[model samples]
Target: MKFLSSLFAIAACGLLAASVFAAEQAPQLSGCAAKRQDITTQIENAKAAGNAGQQAGLEKALSEMNANCTDADLLKQQEQKVLDAKREVSRRQADLNKAMSKGDPEKIDKRKDKLAESRKELQDEQEKLEKVQPDEDDD
Candidate 1:
């Protein structure tokens, strides 16, 4: 009977440990929150790389995010901004790819500029999303 009890105790401990691990791994943010975290990480990476131009752009984007993302009523607008930024990035990527394939210097340069603009837009939207505070009810 003692051996059986010991086994049960070990099993309970294992289950508790597993539950803790699962909870730790679970994502804490949804929607804009998650996007904001991703953008923040990218901004940090850019800063670490010593890319002054990129960092400046990201900082501007972060400022824009800070301004618009905090309002509860603006959630939908922020979401739309994110979607539009994503689409712009996709479009720019496609244009860049096409330009690269064509091997045209002028086209490539123009596409590269467009791609950079799109990237900045994406960063800005992400910053906005990140700045969104969790609803009071979420707690």
Candidate 2:
């Protein structure tokens, strides 16, 4: 009886562990894949409803998503580029601050130009990132 009870306890613990592991393994959708699925569904629904205008728009969106989100590696690279751009902006801002502290007109102008360039780069990178990421509304 004692041995049988111990065996049951061990089995119960094993089952509990397995359940916990399974629960922890949530399904993660690939950015492009999810978008593709969503767009496909929207396209089908639009076609069913005979909404030609909406269908055209959804098709265009789907094509853009396919172009941007298909390559996971490219998406990751774009994300990295955005991070680098943000860092560059921060560095440029620091330089501008230093120039301001020095009270030199020429230095301040140069730093301001650099800062503008950095900000533009950051904005471009952010746009690229947005293209690869899943839209919040899609979720």
Which candidate number would show the highest lDDT if scored against the true structure?
Answer: 2
What local lDDT does model 1 show for residue 121? 86
* Separate clash counts for every candidate: 1, 0
In candidate 1, stretches whose alpha carbon ends up further than 4 angstroms from where it belongs are 1-72, 135-138
Q: Please give the lDDT score for candidate 2.
A: 0.86
lDDT by residue (tens digit), candidate 2, 1-139: 9999999999999999999999689554545665687799999999999999999999999888777665567578889999999999999999999999999999999999999999999999887677676556766
Residue 12 lDDT, candidate 1, scale 0-100 = 100
Error of 1 at 70 (Å): 10
lDDT per model, in order?
A: 0.82, 0.86
> What TM value does model 2 have?
0.48
Give a tens-digit lDDT track for model 1, residues 3-84. Answer: 9999999999999999999979986775545556667877999989998899888887877776656455557778788999
| Candidate number with greatest TM-score | 2
